[model samples]
Target: MTVIEIDGLSKNYGADKAVDGVCLRVEQGEIFGIAGPNGAGKTTVVECASGLRRRDGGNLRVLGLDPQNDRRRLLQRIGVQLQEASLPGAIKVGEALRMYASFYDKPADWRELMDEWGLTDKRRAGFASLSGGWKQRLFIALALVGNPEVVFLDELTTGLDPSARRTTWGLIRNMRERGVTIVMVTHFMDEAAALCDRIAIIDRGRVAAEGSPRELIAKGRADSLEDAFLVLTGGETA
Candidate 1:
């Protein structure tokens, strides 16, 4: 069940090559990670695959459909949670969920989602007042409102404290357990190792190496995934 397929994918910004001849395959019900240092084009890869951005060269398919050609049809079947997930400061939790649900032809009940994500009590709370952790919970809730088969989570736990990060990881695992395919983009090697079934390390706009965390460590002959990433990327920031 290969849900996503890419071969020689490329994207560019002006004269700069943001993604260069990248290839990947993501299967059903797996947590696939795209990890890389800053400016390595990790986000661009997902954006292109998920139909957020158009590619300059090569081919990609998401859920057996061409992302660019079938964007409208694709959007209905996939959910995306971006790193900069944000809403108006005055928007309440319930309001936000309701708004997102309206975007889908067939959506999950936002109220049920609120309760399931522990935001029922905060339904009246304003977006500006919610803590970082609570905001993330809401973001995940919003992503699920469409009841999508595949979800793209980009840098999902980037700024959270340890506790919040762990909680977010639990939420991600819960998504996987429910048989949803996940494509995660992050720079944290430990997070990738902890949650991802397989990872592709992007460096300088190309896939430098890709495998399970342990397999990558074995390939680099390093002590850990982080060390292997550092070795693979020539000490670039993880």
Candidate 2:
């Protein structure tokens, strides 16, 4: 089943195009990735799909529902963790989780989520006091708190240390195991290569290549995903 479908999707910032004629599809229960260098329109595409931004031209569907026309219903079924997410400095970890969980009609237990995400020990810790990795974990927990069928994670592990990044990879795999579909926007080549079942490489507001990591490497005649990305995007891959 296709959970997301986009065709000729385009977005612009005045005269400059951020996303241009992009076409992509995401199937059910797979971790799909959108990889590119900064300013490559990777974020713009997902933002449009998530209904955070409007597209200039094209058709987009999330679970067969129009994102712009059916935003209210779509928001209820999808969870989003933006690239730069934040919370009130004084809010405790548990408090933040509880507050977000309350917004959903059928939310997961916030207490259990804290424990699952290794935030139980820091439940009372203020949001501002948490480290980058901890903050990332909390954001992920909050995104999943609503038990959404589809989850969008943008630059999810950007600031995490190596250990935390790998831990998050495991968590994402767990989410997929439980039948959730994932769409991630990331610049980390190794991260996307390791986690994404398939990926679309966007560059300069267009899709430069689309395939599995191995396929992309072969197409670019490179030994690794990073090198392949660099080759395809003319050294523009992040």
Candidate 3:
């Protein structure tokens, strides 16, 4: 099912056009990827779709409801982890998760969420005291606490080490198995190729190209998605 639909979606910041006439359709129960070079307005597109930012023009819908008009209703069914999402330094892991759970009408058991994400041991740890990987684990657990149908993960593993990144990838795969639809944004083409069911390459506030990993490579006549990204985006590196 098409859980998200955007048509000619546009958002501007000052005189700069952050997103311009961008259109996309995201199916349910799939990991959709939004990828691009820095400053390509990838995050802005998601913010508008998730109802965190108001668009200057065009329209968008999530789960058949307008993001702008049905934001309050939608919040109960969707979760969002922004690229720069963070909590107060002094907050404890358990405290953060519990607090997030309280916002929803029907929430998951936060304690089980902690154990499921391997965060039980870190429950007492302060946000500033945890490692990078631990913090990310907490973030994902918090996102899922609302028992959402859709979750947006922006730059999910930007700074993790190889092992931690792989571990996080496993967690994402597990989410898919449990029937959660995901929208992921990433700079790493390899990660997108590995995890995404479909990907859209955004550039200059618009979609440059979109398809499955192999289809995209075939379309660009490149050996890899990274190479295909460079080819499809006119030499812009992702």
Query: Cα lDDT of all candidates, in order?
Result: 0.91, 0.91, 0.91
Write model 1 residue lDDT over 1-238, tens digit each, in one string: 9999999999999999999999999999999999888999988888898898999999999999999999999999999987776899999999999999999999999999898888999999999999987898889889899998899988878767798788778988988999999999988888999999999999999999999999999988898999998898898544
RMSD of each: 1.8, 1.6, 1.5
Candidate 3 TM-score over all chains jointly: 0.96
Candidate 1 regions exceeding 4 Å error are 236-238
What TM-score do all the candidates reach, one by one? 0.94, 0.96, 0.96
Clashes of 2: 0
lDDT of 3 by residue, 84-172 (tens): 88789999999999999999999999999999888999899999999877888788888899999999998889877888788889988
The deviation in Å at residue 71 for candidate 2 is 0.9
Task: Report the poorest 10 consecutive residues by lDDT, candidate 2.
Answer: 229-238
Instruction: Give the C-alpha miss distance for residue 142 in model 1, angstroms.
Output: 1.2
lDDT of 2 by residue, 74-183 (tens): 88888898888899999999999999998898898999989988999999999999998889889999999999899999999988899888989999999999999999
